[model samples]
Target chain A: MQQSNVYIVTFSVILTVVLGLLLSGTSQVLGPIQKKAVELDTKKQILGAVLEASELSKMSGEEVFAYYDKRISSKVVNIKGEEVEKDEDGIAIIPENVDIGRNYKRKPEDRLYPVFMFLAENGEDVESFIIPVYGAGLWDAIWGYVALETDLTTIKGVTFAHASETPGLGARITDASVQARFQGKRIFDESGELQSVNMQKGEGRDYSDDAHKVDGLSGATITAVGVNNMLKAYMSHYSAYIQKRRSGESGGMAVLN
Target chain B: MSTETAQVTEVKKPAEALLSKRRKKLLSDPLVDDNPITIQVLGICSALAVTTQLQPTFVMALSVIFVMVFANLTISLLRNTIPSRVRIIVQLAVIASLVTLVNEVLKAFAYDMYKELSVFVGLIITNCIVMGRLEAYALGNKPYDSVLDGFGSALGYAWIILAVAFFRELWGSGSVFGVPVFDQISGLFGDDFSLATNGLMVSPVGAFIILGLIIWVQRTKTGYVEH
Candidate 1:
């Protein structure tokens, strides 16, 4: 059958309009659910950095959210460690809303850093602080949460996730064994300088004994370096806060909430 | 008249006409002889990527099946009206719409699987099998036959992926559908059955090897040779 130019044009236009409407409608209906999924996923990852993987995996969605709501408090702070106040409308500026992905584009001094405080059993004692870090891996983006101990110097735990890192190699950062190495490693040296944790190449050296070094993935040197750089860059953003906490100037972990 | 006689024959045996020998072939041929994945080697990317684990592989297969059948039926129904000059775009529009709907539904209902599959679910738009069947069978066939062909080819693609996933997940993670089978074996054998998983099985290389072997075995058994 011969199709005239007019017929083709009309048909194409109608088809495009119908398809566009269908897709947009689907997106509109599912957008909220997808947003909730994303929020839950972020909360779960934040919890994963502090809690055991097995423990985190066992919790239901409601349980994860409830735990997050009850125990974790977030605050947005400037580069100088001062809290960023709410806008003129009095709506509190939530730290969770401060996306680090976008912060990468802004100047260091202008960036608003978020700090997630994990409260202990007493609800007053700050157990650990979790910071989100992300950087480019060998292939794509690699991101993670690093939880600092109450002292604000030692690493409590960490959870690494990646976009498209090489599976069985760089992707092993997501493995529990690799992340476990960061536990108890000091982010600050003996001289009270922020060193961050380095993902060193090779094995046999005791990662636990080194205050500022963790075992890197065997075949993923570029990714390991990427992780090292990400940690250094992100952790430095909280240097003022960490220093203030270390000085005991706020009378031993003041409750921010 | 000939038209009156044709109407009488068509109405006389509707059931027989529905399940004719040719119709059966349309549904069955793609399962073996004209398999889209095994024989034609279409859509190898997702097959290799998602087969690293069974759960994601299963979800991916189902998504492909859904897209294929719906896209085929839509195209077939509009075959005559669709301008030949812009038929490919029309097919693409139908397929993309179905895929986006599937993706949204998955995000709402199966969020975990959606996250695991991630971009792969989006990549279904680019899957050759869906487009190939649309062009080769749907454009020229009736709606019912196009649906059958789409279903058959999807099955052909699915089984290969599922088989690859079975081996990969079993040996790679010592699990099936996330259940640790080897751990159970170890429990039964009282620690003597400790099995170290093959890391290669979790990588793309394992999928390549498994698919290659499957094609080889299938060809040998079917006695089909590429000339």
Candidate 2:
């Protein structure tokens, strides 16, 4: 009911200046700590998916780096079976801030060295190059790394994670139990055609079906279909690389593990 | 002008007599007695939406407390000059600006948690808990008392939310902070892992059930009059 011009002007200026100071000050102080946290967390996720949490936890981050270093080799191979980046480092760099509109789109330029984690007995190493697959899930996008033997046929290991999904239903993709089913499964049929893992339905999946089929998710069928679709989409895009690896080409899809 | 003159004179009485003892009422009142969400039934949407989990609920409560305390203090400081015709707008501008600061800090530092919260944090600008403090208590008090009033209102909102998140995470997934509270048989779930959900902890609707159950418990513990 009351009014004063002096108070109005002073309040606006005071609030604006105080807020400006607070916003800038807090970010300047907290920005780097947040960035480092994110970087470390990503390392944890990559390690967790490739190695058992119990095993990975036993090793320090440097040891994990050393494991990936000794076993994982980064390659920037093009679709034409040519090495894109080859030097002493053996690390292929993927550009950041990729804009694919939706996380499900194919922005082919975003391809680079896919990180591969190999697990075989000592000295034998792994004989496959693994690649990361990004696809749509039930409530959000899902991503996983799929490793292949040097032949690009048999699967080595698969790790998956989701951004947003129903915890009990669609979120099953992140469940280690669900993802573990993907391990040791063959990704190709006897004829050498791509037969990526399947999410089985009601009852149980007969992994020994006449056809090469992994069990599909039953309760969350749509999310299962999403994983199937994304798996196909990723395989198709890199068909050339897959074909090259299958044909025993040496330049692309070299064994890291 | 006459009304202004009369009100000014009225305000000059012993500080105790000029303002009603709204302090003792608001301070101790909301914390337990006349709690907003649990007791009075206000601002339950955010209490449910953000409290489906723990970490975000904690952050949301702190943000509301900060916003409320400052908004209340500022609004009270300018109580004498706020134009009657545009009072709500004035209160809103103060709240909105503070909320923006909160948003930026969350984005720059807690970006991941901020993404998890998504639009809910921005929606804080509309929270009745903050607005109610500004309009009801801050509009007529000294700055310090108004700040205290805001803090009390926020404390009321926080406890209810924490309780909601605790139960939701505990029963829905049978876990706390992502650690499994329930065990699974080996090789039953996937990759030789079997974890159970207890099946009830997955949706926002589930949050409502848990919240209602909590409200029932609180009501039985503390009887109140219909005001």
Candidate 3:
């Protein structure tokens, strides 16, 4: 090969080989950090479901951890309203990043855990907690953690999130303002049958403000309607557990209605 | 005996060698004339997917540029030694390594964007830009020319895709990077003015329309007809 050819060819071979190794090796080094980022984001989402983002934002990370530690206590409960072994039973294991279908298959009798958060709202000393709910959305499953007020109906606040939905449309299921509307909304009628809140289109009409309505995504009727339907599904399934807690049968920790 | 014959053959240019002018055409013409994918109808899948957002388009452009430049240079360097029987296998080996590196880097520093990019980031392995550069130019040219050729075609492809994404994000959501712009127009028109754009803008259908408009503009500007 000529002088110019040898210089460029040898340089090209060495450059490609060395650079490719470096790029691949560097990514492998960064994998753990990236994975940790994903885990932290997931933890934040779970925490947000129970606490208001505005309130959570007010506290530093350490303060938030301390607050959650003191305010929230978790216990495993049986189908018969009795406390199960702390180490055993179904455990309501929400797989950190897995889908609802897999998470749902862990039977209630296997052991479902309930967590209570003690706080005060509207001049009333209150105990609030979150219950996990799952249902279908427009293109996939819709799931959320709903934080309930002492009455176990009015939403204190909510944080909803989803996967693979249209960006500005179905994705609004996770938006802040939409979640705020669920606040002060009742989940059941006086008779104790599940009457979940409605998400209505156009200028929202608050049914009674306390047991009322939320404004639906204007152009995303299907996704809006999915959320409303799923709310009913969550409310009805969890009503039995809520009923026992309401009767003060699970101690005075939670008052349903 | 074999060594003497090899030494005798080393001094002469092969009769079958592609001339300099033709090699220049192979490198330069993809940007305008005889484009491998766009004009010649090759790798349209990526053209539709990543063009919905500018950031992804930028990443895709970077990936394509790296792959094209390196794939061409590597192929050109190995052109003399590679056996005719195994040349395609060798080409794939080089392309695959470049793509894996692209995936790994994106996965490392830009994890969120990498997740959003998903399979498309990995799909650069199959993107014909790498293959076309290898076969049409790299297999015969010197390494320097191959590198420039790779850069030229990748840029040619990127310019069109980024321009398409620019309009898609701007008109689709009336926002850039999720910040609501076009707020003035929306406010003036009231409810009649919709800044909350059609989700279709991010969808594949939007990409098709934008690409067509681009090709139409490019054609009109160049007065070229595709048969």
Candidate 4:
């Protein structure tokens, strides 16, 4: 059957209105739940850097949130290592709310760095500081969290995630075994210069004795290089904060220790 | 005589029961005889892309099935009113909306699965099987028959991709659904024997090779010859 121009126009308009309403309705209804899921995932990644993945996997979302509240406290810091209570917009900066991906596009100095501190059992003393890092991978964006011991040089643990990478190749960055390679690796060399941990080319090499080198994925040199660059860039970005903490520890606590 | 029989059947088709033999054929024929992937070769891109792992492929299949069935039904219901000039656009709008719904639902309820299948779920809007079925069957068929046809085509697409994933994940990662099967097999024997994983199977090339073999086997069994 032939449809006249007026009828066609009317049909198209009605279809657009109906579909627009339906889509907007669905989005509005699901928006909060989706936001919560994303928040939980981010928290999981942050905690994954400090806690065991197996343990985290077993916890429900509510349990993970409770555990995060118990063991973690956070603060935003500037490039100069000073605490940032409020952002340029005058809004109070919450470390958990900081978006690393959005900040990644801004100038290094302009970015707000959120530091999540893992508190010791006494709950007051800081155990390890987990810093989030972001960069590009071969296929898409790559990001991770790195936890540093109180001394602020040794990597306590790490967890990596990627948006799109070759499943068994570049994507192996998320593997626990791979992240475990970063444990105990120091960011600062003996000379006290910040030298970020390197993911060297090729796998199966024993980097156990090396302070700054971890084995790379065999077939994923580009992704390995991406990780190497990401670690170096983010570590250097946090260097000022690290130096400040280091000096503060030695300066204030000299008699107690 | 054949023309007279065809006319008689055509006259009787509308009054037939919901699950009549003709409708059953509409539901079952696509499994092998007119498969969206193997025989019709309609949605080969996703079949190759998501087949690298069983878990994501399974989710992809489910999403496609959901999208296809609903898209077909919606289009069939609106078949009479849809202007031929704007029918493609209408079909696309319906399909895209349904896919967005699936995506939003996944994000809210199964976030991990949503993350794993994010881009692929959006890509379902472009999968030709949905469009092809909407145009070929839904535009002229009744709603129930269109739905059955859509389900059949989606199932046909699903089984092929799932089979490809089975081989790919089993060989590529030496696992099934993330379980390290090869590790267990080696552990069963000891250090004396171990099967090296085929890394090629983890790549898109592996999907192509596996899909090609599947199409070849399926076509050979069905005796389908392309002119």
- The lowest-lDDT stretch of 10 consecutive residues in candidate 2 chain A is A94-103
RMSD of every candidate to native, in Å, equals: 4.1, 6.0, 7.7, 3.4
Best lDDT among the predictions, by candidate number: 4
lDDT score of residue B38 within candidate 1: 88
Off by over 4 Å in 4: A253-257, B1-15
Fnat for the candidates in order: 0.73, 0.38, 0.22, 0.87
State the TM-score of the second chain for every model.
0.92, 0.82, 0.81, 0.93
TM-score for each candidate, following the candidate numbering: 0.90, 0.76, 0.71, 0.95
lDDT per residue for candidate 1 within A1-257, as digits (tens), equals 46679978988888889888988988998899888887888899889889999999899988999999989988878888888877447878877666777787788888888889999876776889998887888998888899998778889999999888876778889999899999999988888887999999975467666788888788899999999999998888879877766665456444343
Better of 3 and 4 by DockQ: 4
Candidate 3 or 1, higher TM-score: 1
lDDT of 1 by residue, B1-227 (tens): 11111222223344557768988898788888988888999999998899988999999999999999999999878877887767788888898889889889988888878878989999999999999999887887768888999998998999899999999989888899989898888898786669888889988999999999999999999999888
Model 1 spans with C-alpha error above 4 angstroms: A86-92, A248-257, B1-13, B17-21, B182-196
Task: Report the TM-score of the second chain of model 4 against its true counterpart.
Answer: 0.93
Per residue, candidate 4 scores C-alpha lDDT tens digits across A1-257 of 46689989999999999999999999999999999999999999999999999999999999999989999999989899888999777988879889999999999999999999998887788899999999999999999999999889999999999999888899999999999999999999998898899998888999889999998899999999999999999999999999988887888865312
Error of model 4, residue B142, in angstroms: 0.8
- The DockQ-derived docking category for candidate 1 is acceptable
Q: Indicate the TM-score of model 2.
A: 0.76
lDDT of 2 by residue, A1-257 (tens): 34467655766667568766876786678777656545544555555555776787688656765675465544545445455664347654442212222434535544443434454546355556566678778777877767666567666566776777767777777766777777667667777677776776642756754334567666788888788777666766566666765555455444522
TM-score for chain A of every candidate model? 0.91, 0.75, 0.67, 0.95
